[model samples]
Target: MSIDSIDAAPPATAQTEQAVREQALVEEVIRSFASGGSDRDREVMNSLVRHLHAFIRDIRLTEDEWSKAIGFLTRAGHITTDTRQEFVLLSDVLGASMQTIAVNNEAVGDATEATVFGPFFVENAPQIDIGGDIAGGAAGEPCWVEGTVRDTDGNPLPGARIEVWEADEDGFYDVQCSDGRTAARAHLFADKDGRYSFWGLTPTPYPIPYDGPVGQMLEHYGRSPIRASHLHFMVSAPQKRTLVTHIFVDGCKYLDRDSVFGVKESLIKEFAAQPAGTPTPDGRDLGGREWTRARFDIVLPPAGPSTATATKTS
Candidate 1:
């Protein structure tokens, strides 16, 4: 063969050159967002581009896979409604929601740990006073919950707003009911001493809304969609950080395998079971039915910028 013809052959470095070209494309996309936007927006987009490209490259993603992902996201968007948030469920099942919470809520002093804010929180929940019933006729074994809202320094945060919600024993939130029945959720305020009490329901394990795109993803990954038994709480005071968390049932079987990856050991509390005819804390009649009670004292961290402080265990 002629020397010129031999020298024109492709070199063994062709694959490496191809990778460089691919990475150049990634950089080009990132630079498109680098200008003309706010600093934070640019930062987020650049990071997202870099990480997303790395993921695709790492998996050597195929065109079929990319198409399937696009379809999955489109279906998620289609299924979302005012009452149902499929995208939040997607983030929850992937542990993204909990990771974001961990980044924003630093462990300061004895402050309560935060967890995933599930897809069921609603605005303008009915207001109840301390020692009032919040179940709102939800069906379940009655549970009496009492707690004191205090700062990390142990100062009572009286008048703190406490919002609580949970699934009924049948494993459905009020918003999920077909008849638009409002139950199993309410809001109340702390008393003068930062103490609050309300009658709710003993939480039960429930699968997140399945039969959706998120559910199909979980099924494909061989993951369960059932979350641990718990009651959701969002507590806030004037000068304190708003805390979104859950007090899990200590003995729940799903605690270790919570679908949303939201179970924190410090957030688990024992729900003391009471027999029939037991004296209630507020002297309410249960009519010869068994009940349970739980106490969850919440300590709020101060409102401030996000920190990376190590979490303190209770």
Candidate 2:
């Protein structure tokens, strides 16, 4: 028989029978989890369903409110594209993304602590040779950044792929502006001795974009939309694990006043300006202007395979 004929014969139920049948359907849905899903997945989904239902009932949400919420979500989606992610911005503002990163980065012993990778990262930054200048042809003051990647035991880890990117002096990522140029960002494979060095502009504090709803929320609370100057790093190796973090520039105007509250005391590093003619590493003209320098270290823990779903970095 056709499926239409089967559908026509399905409603032979009184109110009591309907209720019982609904309960059976619910049980059947719950039991379906046991058929193929992992125990952990099944448990989590069941708990999520329960709490989600409970929340809906507890709020007694009206249809108008529901419609408004849906509209807000649609707007959020509309604001996101390849370079910008409104959902991640929402998660950042709500602090859920950072919380989840913290939960997943719990490390024992002396492993380097993990932090949320901000939403502005771009993959495949122009790969440069070791000791190459990343801050190409920019107007900001120059800085020499040198760092070593090592395990918790302090052994240099070779062959680590160190990916580095950062905002310009104006507090904008390369992708943020339409200049079609990317300075202060590059990818470099580590040397045999696990040391890495690059030249970039001295990081200056910058303001977060305040043109969107997140900005409105910040304004509603009388908050400043500023984040401290920092250099973003994502270091990974074939045998070892990966770390996504930033080296906060010390003495930044917004260090103590980050709008997103992303700074940690330990991550902050001094970027001291050296006297002129301080012997350039490249033996080039140092001019009369002072240069800045910093040394940072990255520590990686055991490797964890990437999850199927995208996990928001803070």
Candidate 3:
């Protein structure tokens, strides 16, 4: 039967004999998982089974719909690779990534808020010295980014490692390119005074990779894949909580509706525009090309036990 016909049918009646059987089945599945497993595993599985059964009951899910979902997951698995993670994209668009981040990173006094760690981050990114250019050879207007790493008590965090990466003007990360070239990504350490600066591209709004199953799902739901203009940052220091976040462009139109729901009001900053011939911080000549500058002072919270529970933020 067609999906239209199924939808047009009357809703199933509750409290029937079949409904009691369904409830027993749910309990049986939960018991199967609860029988033999680690405490954490059993806890998670039991809760998952309960929620899954509840969702199936709430929607009165059709067999065809379940098959279609399995097919979509299979397609996502097929497209995922070392360079492309379609499952991560799926989690991102559904706000699961952001929700997970929110649960893990609790709010500390005066500390920078955490956001999504996007799928594009690669291990062992090239290291750059302070005041170096992270853009490498990416195609975009020049931007001067300066920042200081400090702890919540207002003490500088020297030797902190900062990993920065972003898409180019066309909204494609280095890994997305076909030539196996790496640009627009690098890691640098804070100076003795906890100061670090680098040159990168001006932030621009870009669509998350949408040529896969997630894209098709978004289209089916009438949603856009465009993300807010932002630069990714992951900072870590000894004996301090690590932070993975972004500094979004203040005036980006998509800030309110980022595809991943990663934007936080505290993370937005002004990218002050400079006319051509504006002297850069390091006095590097831009050849009369206009550029922008932004300063982001990062504050890391003290490393300690998590005070928050793993609750969904969405």
Candidate 4:
């Protein structure tokens, strides 16, 4: 008998009645959300319910398993606070963060591709001059980073703001330090020619603070929690899209296996070794010890128009 004809007819047994009831339950829950305040919210919730109900039906999840999942989420929320963001970390390791960024920010004419912003970014980082050192004596071999920001047309984008942050040689960010003073991170501005230079440290592989629930989950899956060595940058300019990205060290040990899956071929960079006493691009001496030099050029995209411009364009 056809399934539709069977549904139209009266249920013949307890099993059939339960199956109809289960299907009705899914639809009833969806209908109950008609009062959601916004169309977007209603649409999202409706879609979520459909998928979740289908998944439950397909998997036939047990009550105990569902309860455990709820407990896990509750714990994730409990551990999340001002300094620690367990939910973002959870999204990151699951590759959801990168997927969302990719879907939302499609490429813009060869502009720099965006990536996951990780959980370490801090607002209001200190501003450093073009040739200044942002590392502030963090432990690692010195590395000089020089780059320029420009548009796809090769025109320099002067006055762009660059925010940078990275872990020290020991694989700890300044925020993780006991003193709470920022190190190895600062804000810098592109000069008139769109060039920027800063003294930082060479990238080093490190674990992603894996003592939390996410770590426990990784352990369960027998996965390593190592992230590749990389320096993070967020560049912004008026009328241009802000870019959040990272420059991966060419030979970083965990490049192929970054815990959060943030590595991209376009972002990999070579950290060339420089002999002592070599003159830097800004006329500073590389003094006495071997230092690394890496050059990364950024390409920004045109931003969406402001209200006035949008109105005019429309």
Candidate 5:
């Protein structure tokens, strides 16, 4: 029989009657959110209810599973702190952060691709010179990174601001410092020629804070928590889009399976090995140990009238 005929004869049995009642209950719950405070709030709440209800129905989810999910969220919140953000970590592991970035920051021309703005970024990094060091007493092999910023039309952007931060050789950011001292982070400005360089540590593969509830979720699915070796950059120039991105260490073991799925082929850069005793760009002697060099160029798109100052830097 056709769906129209099938629906016409539906609520005769007790089971059918109960099913109809349940369907009406779900609809009423969804509709109740229509009067939320603002249009955006109403839209968000209404859509959330619809999708959530549909999911609950599709899975025929048990009350036990629902309670477990709530408990997981509670634990995530409990573990969150000024130093740690379990929620962002959870979103990153689930690919939702990357997906949201892809949706909102669609690539324009040769503009640099953005990854997660990760929860680690701190405003007001100490400013340094164009070729100064950001290691700040952190322990690791020195790496030289130089890059240029330009517009989509290839015009150089002088005085662009660049902020950089990364983990030490052991894979912990400055904010995660056990001694409560900042390290491996700084800000600098581009030169008149649109070039900026700095001394940083060659990034090493590190595991995310896997001692939390998010980690438990990953463990439940048998997923590794290792992120690829990389350096983070937040570049901004006047009249250009602010670009938040990273350059992955070429040949890093986790490149193929970054825990947060942040790796992009174009963002991978080779950290060239330099022999010991080589002279550095800023005229410093390399001394005994071999050093590494990586260069990443950023291209930003016009920010239009909405974007404000890009005046801060390294």
Candidate 6:
């Protein structure tokens, strides 16, 4: 019964083989996927195997726990639909999507930082004129938003295209409009001088939809589902870079506690109440009560042409 005989046992190559068998089974399932999928499918599946195996090894996972995890993922997949993406919602809540976006699109200089688009971005938004209000007839306080697109050198980058959209006063976006299409959702490109402006009613803070499994997951984790009041922008330039960010409304209670953790101090802007005679460029009367206005200048990095070749010096 010597201690040396117990701790000096030989390595278990058989146990390592069993672990490989389990990992191989997972890869077999993934390899059966057919067309229309990207090449990253295999890459992701392989990486997933390594990480998942590592997790199991770290926890010494039991069969019961593994079965429970499988059931949870199955339910998450079943809860997905055309309008609702439970998977994307899961990614957002876990900060995976934000991390992925940041890794792929590293912002240089003063360019805006991109965050998760969430699961509510809908394609084919209605194109509206300059200075048009996308807020529709929603009853909320008026807010004027203006901004210019410039390069890192503080010069205007003309002809930049800026796509804008936001939730209504009720925190319901146009895609979320169960009835007819709402007027508060529109896309407007920048003016010739790289300036883009628009008017809209202030968006209200609202809890994300809690009728689904994602909601249940949030509640189980003791988390709230409220996002701060802000406007979404996707700005792109011809030769420069593109940006996806939010112009956060000032004094929002949820600014510090955005459900997705998307609030940035530099992104926040003042939303002051303006007078009735605010000379609206589009002839829309934002009069009567006071309105909130914010102006932000976006800066994009230089183009990719100069990325190659070193400069010759004496």
Q: For residues 77-98, what per-residue lDDT tens digits would candidate 6 score against the true structure?
A: 8877776677777776776666
Clashing pairs in 5: 128-314, 187-313, 187-314, 188-313, 188-314
- What lDDT score is found at residue 92 in candidate 1? 83
Model 3 clash tally, residue pairs: 0
Q: For each candidate, how many residue pairs have backbone atoms clashing (under 3 Å)?
A: 0, 1, 0, 0, 5, 4
* Residue 48 lDDT, candidate 6, scale 0-100: 63
Under the 3 Å rule for N, CA and C atoms, how many clashes does model 1 have?
A: 0
Prediction 6 global C-alpha lDDT: 0.69
List model 1 lDDT by residue over 139-237, tens digit each: 999999998999999999989999999999999899888898889889999988999999999999999988999999889889999999999998988
Give candidate 1's whole-model lDDT.
0.86
lDDT (Cα, tens digit) per residue for candidate 3, span 1-314:
54323323333765566777887787788778866879999888877776677768768899999999999999999998888888888888988888778777888899999888888888899999888999989999999999899999999999999999999999999998999888999999999999999999999999988899999998999998999999999899988888888999999999998988999999999999999988999999999999999999999998877522222121
Q: Where does candidate 6 stray beyond 4 Å?
A: 1-43, 275-284, 303-314
TM-score of each: 0.92, 0.80, 0.92, 0.88, 0.89, 0.80
Would you give me the overall lDDT of model 2? 0.72
Which stretches of candidate 1 lie above 4 Å from their native place? 1-14, 307-314
RMSD of each: 7.4, 8.4, 5.6, 6.2, 5.1, 8.5
Deviation in angstroms for 305 in model 2?
A: 7.7
Whole-model lDDT values for every prediction: 0.86, 0.72, 0.87, 0.82, 0.82, 0.69
Q: Candidate 2, 115: how far from true, in Å?
A: 1.4
**How much is 202 displaced in model 1, in angstroms?**
0.4
**Candidate 4 C-alpha RMSD relative to the actual structure:** 6.2
Q: Check candidate 2 and list the clashing pairs.
A: 116-314
Which residue pairs come into collision in candidate 3? none
**Ranked by lDDT, top first:** 3, 1, 5, 4, 2, 6
**What TM-score does candidate 5 get on C-alpha atoms?**
0.89
